[model samples]
Target: MATIREELQAAVKKLFDDDKIDYFVGYAEDYGHTFPAILTKDSDPSRLTFDRKSYDNLANFLPELRGSRVGLICKQCEVRTLNVLAAEEQVERDKLVVVGVPCPAMLDPRKLTEGAADLDSLDESYWQEKCRRCLERNTPLADVFVGERVSTPTPAEGWPLLEEVEKMSAEERLAWWRRQMSLCIRCYACRLACPLCYCHQCFVEDNKPQWIDKSVAPENNLHYHIIRAVHLAGRCIECQECSRVCPVGIPVDVLNNVLSRDFAERFGYVSGETAETQPALTRYERDDKEDFIL
Candidate 1:
């Protein structure tokens, strides 16, 4: 149950001492909080750090570091993404090291702005609401783990927003989505921030009879979002980065969560429970409740 800084240094030092790694990709204190930074042989241990604002899912470092060995910190969401990448052959398994950590909760930048003038002094109560319902603060799938696993807190039984949306008439739902889509800028910040949207050629970038128009207007925006969400339906780990990175502050995770909850309830599946478990869509059982077409 060491502090993130202590465990990080020990992990890095062990890798280097054993000549097992040439570089360690992890977070180090950055001015006010921790951000991703690569530590090499000559790096200083003083650079390593961990704290509340260390919100970046370290798995984002994997795809970009292709063919190189990596050691990364993972929360439940990040680990799910790494598992998806491994299944796709985008991440090299033998060369990677996973350091799972118990994530208490992550704060929204907007919440950060509303609460504290400085990140260090931000109130614990203002931390993301997701933390309140978190069931798996400590991850199970790590080559080496960092903290004493905290017991998963009992999750609140309802997603009020999702339920409210369900209560909307179809026309009302459509109208609401249209209004939200009107604000999209199509900068792809949401896509880039997502750990699971790592396709080599994202649909928005495809030009051969491109499936979606590039205009940031509502038509294109809605189309793009629908396509993106479908691609992530079963794969999303509820990292909420898409919503977090949006410049216009769209609640994009709402869409992803809708599907994730559906996947869990309909199929009895959850993402990132293990690094190697197959995606639900990738397999099917004959006894599955819906398999009978009669």
Candidate 2:
């Protein structure tokens, strides 16, 4: 049987030969690190590969590639992101050729030993927190699937870290967030890494309103993050890329996860499950619960 990597390379080549795509977004090995690569028709299809390290949400590259037909390798999370993007009208579904892959849970880079070899030999303990709780392993939407379907892991119970934070008193929670904010350098990697944060001008950049101060401070950082969480309340797909890219190692996704859980409980909504469902915040019913409103 052909390995998944070989299958992916062959599939991408076929897409190019079929004139189904103008560009292909996938992972390539460089300097021992697997990183996102944008391949043109002239580029070598052999460069394409997928593995645990192929953790990037490839959909993040799609908005910039608009007006061109693009093919991309998508895991379940990336598929969900595409669904959200399509529903938001940020992407033209017809212009995309989604090559779906079964995700075998990504390894947490932080937990990896130096020169870790035989990544495939590692067990579930080495997986990222999000992966442990992932409910879907196969892409829910795809133009073509390139791998055998993998068995989905039984999802772990509720978010432990979020539960820990919830247990804290109001004052303690405020202080805890302040400490996390203090470590931020305000690099905005969290926003940039997000596939949904495609706004041309984020609120912070608006000089006319000056929504957030340019200087980095705990209060200012907290304000920025709070506003960001609000914006993503009903839209965040919980890919956990924000926390993954945080230089300070702050658990940024916890805020989004909190809202995700609440939305599920209060409104029975889960973001990015399908392209047809409107975002929870985008639509309101006459019977919608407003207990959170003060």
Candidate 3:
């Protein structure tokens, strides 16, 4: 029997041989780090691999490759992202091939101790927070399935860090967020890493009315993040990439998570679950509650 990696490589090779894709986006391991790799028909498929460290949401690269037929490896979160992107008309589904893979949950690099060479020795405690709460291990949608399906874990309860913040008073929560925002260097890695933040020109770059100051102060950072959270209120898939890529470890996804939870409870909306469902904030029904509008 072929190993999972070998199977995935073979599947991708078939796509190329069938002329189904112009470009393939997947993960490649070098030294000890795994990073996203883009391959063409001429590139070696053996370079493609997936492991516990293959945590990047490959859908983030789709917009740039819009005109080309692209094939990408989709884990559960990436599958959700693809659905959201397709619904938003961001990508042409017909021009893309999705190769589904069973995710074994990515290990949190932060939790790994120094010299922790043995990944198999770690357990669920070492998994990323989003992975810990993941309800699906098998890709929900795929053009071609590559691996044996893995059983999904029971969904975890509320996000612990988000709950911890919620327990604080409004003022306390504001202060906590202020401290986190203060550490931001304004690099905007969080926005860039997001698969849904595909605006051609971000608001911060607008100088017409200057929506935000160019300074790197806490207030400016807070304003930028607040607007970002509001924009992603119904669109964020909680892949946790915003928090994962933060240089200051600000847990930026907490803001998006708060909105995701609220939308789930108040509007019964879950983003990226299906391509047919419109984003919560984009569509409004007559029955929408407006008690907080006053």
Model 3 clash count equals: 0
- Identify the runs in model 1 with alpha carbons over 4 angstroms from their true place: 1-3, 113-125, 291-294
Tens-place lDDT digits, model 3, residues 128-183:
99997786888877888887888988978888999999899999998998899889
Between prediction 1 and prediction 2, the one with superior TM-score is 2
Candidate 1 clash pair list: none
For residues 1-294, what per-residue lDDT tens digits would candidate 2 score against the true structure? 999999999999999999999999999986878889999999987767898988788999999999999999988788889989998998999999989889989988888889888998889889888898787898877889988998997888799889999999999999999899999999999999999989999998898988889999999998888899888988999899999889889999999998999998999888988878787878998878888894
Candidate lDDT scores, in order, read 0.75, 0.90, 0.90
Worst 10 residues of 3 by lDDT: 112-121
- The per-prediction tally of clashing pairs is 0, 0, 0
- Model 1 lDDT, residue 110, Cα: 70
Query: Could you report the Cα RMSD, in angstroms, for every candidate shown?
Result: 2.8, 1.4, 1.4
lDDT of 1: 0.75
Off by over 4 Å in 2: none
Cα error, residue 38 of model 1, in Å, equals 2.6
Question: What TM-scores do the predictions have?
Answer: 0.88, 0.96, 0.96
